[model samples]
Target: MKKTMLLCALLMSAFAAHAQESRQDVSISATGTFSPTIHGATGTYTNTDTSLGALVSYRYLLTPRSGLEANYSFTQNTPRYVVPGTSDNNVHLRQQEFSGAYVYTMTFKRYNPFVEGGVGAMFFSPIKDFQTTQLDVKRTTVLGGLFGAGVAYELSPSFDIRAEYRGFLGKTPNLGHEAFTTNRYRVLSMPTLGIAYHF
Candidate 1:
């Protein structure tokens, strides 16, 4: 974690110096986010879980109104569900994803409204102790897509506050479903808040 913070600080400093030259259309940023997933399932089970993650991104301004973004994020923690007459089940799902996106940004007097969509791959790891001791599954990689929008407020010339909502759609080896119970792959949406420095 210290290494991550140091790297981010160094990158921000580099960007700060670069911004003075010409306000480089291409900006690099690091974002730390808290994400929770709410699965659309009911009765005897619930897939409400949360995670903390970080992303490193490079955003290139394609034009005044549109741009392209590439991002890589690390997220962890699986969903948990409780069952009657059995031990509590816990799954540890960790994901590392890389995505390319198209962004439409609108600048207001003090707020910037942006919408983004992208496609990527998510890697999921499973912990079977939460389900049955006899059950063991290998990690899987799945393709996914995401879409979201957010607003950013400029706090200063170098810093900005941002809030965003994003969703991921993917499939895997029934991380939440079992033989007697089949689980469907669906989209997971998350909202995040953070700060970014533009160089």
Candidate 2:
């Protein structure tokens, strides 16, 4: 239809204008994930494995100093559980995070330091294998909060390398089973380094 074509043309025009102004950027990063041991009050505890992962981020600047960002991360690790004298249990899980945040940036020379805070959900899916000891466990999702502080060094008009530390606060994943339940909360630390391309 003519109307549909007109709308599509307008949308493309807007996007082209936005890209010309360098108002958006996309980043891909490698991360090192570290989670501390969590001890529950009811004699339950969890120890999570340190692992390597990846993060993808998109940002749209509302102003020169403020913007909105969306981030997705993927990591797979194992968590070992100890529940009051039961045999040790460990589950191999693929964990994912989906979050959106408000990003504030300050510029000094070519270094842009930024901070962000947001809310999201964490999903843990157990992989059935010899490494996973619990058969009854299933997938679990929990709401959580994430915060980060980092600096991006501008290499050119369209490229930069960034380093950051981000933390996620959430309840320990129990996978819908008592033996693995900690009924406690913990923080997962992610340190990242990567490059970004502006558009």
Candidate 3:
């Protein structure tokens, strides 16, 4: 019994020491985002917009090649009308998303390539008119999903630069409280650049 207990204690101590030596457990990143046109319909109007945005993410590595990540991003653009006489009149359309993903990474020397998939919620808000006091004409929340791929180049043991392309899928947003004449879907393509710090 005494020998067995000693053996287990020794094994536990070795594991703790190894964990300390391999401490790349947490990472944080800041990103700049660009999104191309998103198309959808609400009532009789079609919505299309391009946007520039920002994102921040936190990741916890479960292993060398696998991690869980949470991210938040915000984007704003002006929706172009498909109708002949309709005009945006300079109003801005805005979206904010919060998501969680599972990431898989492949590591080689100083470069790591990764793929991720996730689901979350998005908040949409639109401005009625740029010249008026109505900042948010309507606000709504909807389900959203994402898939992405990226490459990270390590600058040091603790920092890296990353670039990624992501696609966001969701139902078309209705800018007002009226009933929808059509239920449409939209996919927004986003490219991002960021720097990550690992600890």
- Which regions of candidate 1 are displaced past 4 Å? 1-48, 80-89, 127-135, 172-183
lDDT of 2 by residue, 1-199 (tens): 9999999999988876765599899999999899999888888888988999999999999998999999999999999988897888899999999999999999898899999999988999999999998888999998999999999999976889999999999999889997666788888999999999999
lDDT of 3 by residue, 79-171 (tens): 543433443433466678898999999989899999999998888777566532334347778798999999999887667898888778887
For model 1, where is the 10-residue window of minimal lDDT? Answer: 22-31
Q: Which candidate is the best by lDDT?
A: 2
Provide the lDDT at 12 for model 2: 86
28-78: candidate 1 lDDT, tens digit per residue: 333333333333343334353556777666667767678787877777765
* Higher-lDDT candidate of 2 and 3: 2
Task: Tell me how candidate 1 scores on lDDT.
Answer: 0.64
Candidates sorted by TM-score, best first: 2, 3, 1
TM-score of each: 0.67, 0.89, 0.73
Clashes of 3: 0
Candidate 3 global CA lDDT score = 0.69
